[model samples]
Target: MSVLRRVGMTLGLPVILLAAWWFASAGSTSFFFPPLSEILDSLVEEWFGPRLAADVWPSLYRLAAGYALAVVVSLALGVLIGTSRTVRALTEPVFEFFRAIPPPVLVPIFILLFGLGDGMKIVVIAFGCMWPILLNTVEGVRAVDEVLSDTGRVYGLRGWSRLRRLVLPSASPQIFAGLRQGLSVAIILMVISELFAAENGLGYAVVQAQRSFAIPETWAGMLMLGLLGFLLSLLFRLVESRQLAWYHGLRRAQRSS
Candidate 1:
């Protein structure tokens, strides 16, 4: 498709939905269905005004910290489990059982252990993000070509060098896919945990606004969360595109052929 056509296709649904929402709710008198214009005003005044610093930024910080921790731990354990049949066999069942237990179900336990602080919420978010990443990394690493390992050995690439030069590059595409999944999961947990345990976050702000019958502000808080999630996903894709440019180039060549 032409660039302009692709852009239109991408934007089409969201634009249509937004337009539909605008017109359908334009004359809304229902408190629950405030007009989009009023909602936008609340978003600007409530969120962009001071809630940006008080609620939004704190939530972003928690998300960043939790997700970053998840990435590091997932990659480390994933590499170990992926590269070793013994480790994978030992851990797979346990990991599977844990992953099956929904993260929210464990929220109370986490709160009990870590208290209703950032620590509890961050840990919850990290746990929520870990499973997909761990599984994907294991899949990626195990799929790395044996020939590449042999080639690395022949060239005297040992231990960390072998992993850095051969394993990571080969597994990166799947790893990044896992990272993207984990990112979304992280964001969900970030908000959900905030709703329950946090004193200050976008989620907390929304809860407060709703309890006070400030529907527009509630919508505004939700809108801020939506925007934050969108922007974070966009940033991840840009980074992924940059890092995987070579992989993308090869795919393009194959498609063209």
Candidate 2:
């Protein structure tokens, strides 16, 4: 598809929804649901200046730190557990217990341990996001074909080389699936973490606005988060496409055959 067509297809629903919201809420007198135009104006006014640097950057920073931590730790632990049946068997029940708990519930515990600071928020986000990626990585590593493993061994693809060339490539699909899921979880946890005892962040800003009866500003903050999420997801898709280009091509060829 042409770039213009692709853009249209991508943005069509959102644009339509925005238009509907604009018209529907244009005459609204409700304090909670302000006019879309007013919300947009508030977004531009509040976010286009100092608040952007003060609130937005901090939130983004925490999100990146937490998500990066999750990805690294999960990949390492996942590989270790997946490659060794003994480790997997020992860890499965513990992993299952932790995974079964809702991440939000741990926020209070984390706050008590780490205090109400960026450390607490980041840890919360990382802990919440880790499970999906970790589980997926474990499954992917376990699914590697024995023939491929033997072939790699025969070719002297030992240690890091074996993992990089054989294990990682074969597991990339599931890892990416987990990464995608984890990204969403990370965003959610970032906000939720901030909602509790946070001085600055997108969630804190929104909650403050609502408490102060600045309905338009609250809506604006929400819109900002939604837009940020969409942009992040789009960026992830682009990166995923580039990284997995060969995998996608192979799949297409297989389907054709």
**Best model number under lDDT:** 2
Name the lDDT value of residue 208 in candidate 1. Answer: 86
Over 159-246, each residue of candidate 1 has an lDDT whose tens digit, in order, gives 8988998999999999999999999999999888998857899888899899999999988888888888888887898899999999
TM-score, each model? 0.95, 0.97
TM-score for predicted model 2 compared with the true structure? 0.97
TM-score of 1: 0.95
Q: Per-residue alpha-carbon lDDT of model 2 for 1-257, expressed as tens digits?
A: 69899899899999999999999999999877889999999999997677799899999999999999999999999999999999999999999999999999999999999999999999999999999999999999999999999999899998898999999999999999999999999999999999999999999998999899998898899999999999999999999999999999999999999
Q: What is the lDDT of residue 44 in candidate 2?
A: 97
Query: Model 1, which residues run further than 4 Å from truth?
Result: 1-12
Question: Each prediction's Cα lDDT score?
Answer: 0.91, 0.95
Error of 1 at 19 (Å): 2.3
Model 2: residues >4 Å from true position, as ranges? none
Q: How far off is residue 232 in model 1, in Å? A: 0.7
